[model samples]
Target: MNNDERIHLLAKELIPLYDDLAADTRLVVEEHARTCKICNEELRRFNATFAPLAAKEEVEPNAEIKPFKKLQAFKALMVGLLFLARFLLIGLLVAAFDPAAPRLLGGNIIMFYFPLAAASLSILYFFYRKLWFWVLVLFDVFILFFLDEVIYYLLL
Candidate 1:
């Protein structure tokens, strides 16, 4: 092909190469564009479309807004509480309707704790790496293990 035809074919890829192609490939395209007026103009036209956005400075959030809001902590805690309650809620529902549903350890009503604890730990999927996540998990484990005694003492 003639030099002009080669430049025309390569110019079509200038925009994509400039935006996202691998560094080595982009460098090769850029070298060709540097020598070809057509490719140079094509790349410049593509960049000009984004220049306005790139030139604009980002505004900071309002000073009144806290960056690390405690609302997240509250939400995580509330979800953790819900996780702990799910066991008792499901167990009570089953026992109330069936009246003959089996209980943990022959008579204890804490049978649901095992599966619910797994669900409770899964809360980390939402609150991963948060301080409240580990705290709630440990608390859930403690309650999971001692829920029978906890109920007995509460009744007394």
Candidate 2:
């Protein structure tokens, strides 16, 4: 077959792969499209729709939440904004929480680790250079674990 015919055939076969696609799959689809015009045109449309999405700038919620359903969103937003604006002041926050808070009043420090882990992962994702992230994580873990062991020893 001529180049246009070959591309058309390939595109007809491969266009469905566009839904969940990647570079390797695209390359394979393109290989067949190179010899067919019809397939090439379809590939162009598929790439237009799928490529930008695969580039992944951000993740939107799958569906919109209703107003009442968004109460948690507002609570989360306030907590996130405050936590971000004054991250360094978190040590002070520990002391400032209501004394009647069961988790805090009980001296159960495990409750604190969840926020710490989230903060740690946020820093890693923002600073996505893998080596520096791993080094910082290891260093933080070492320090925290050592501090915990020391505290445990002292308490014993």
Best by lDDT: 1
Runs off by more than 4 Å, candidate 2: 1-11, 22-24, 56-69, 73-156
RMSD of 1: 7.9
Model 1: residues with Cα > 4 Å off, grouped in runs: 19-41, 54-75, 83-106, 112-119, 122-156
RMSD of each: 7.9, 14.0
lDDT (C-alpha) at residue 74 in model 1: 78
Q: After superposition, how far is residue 97 of candidate 1 from its true place, in Å?
A: 22
Q: List the residue pairs that clash in candidate 2.
A: 3-35, 4-36, 4-37, 6-36, 7-35, 7-36, 7-39, 8-36, 8-39
Candidate 1 lDDT score at position 142: 67
Q: Cα RMSD for candidate 2?
A: 14.0
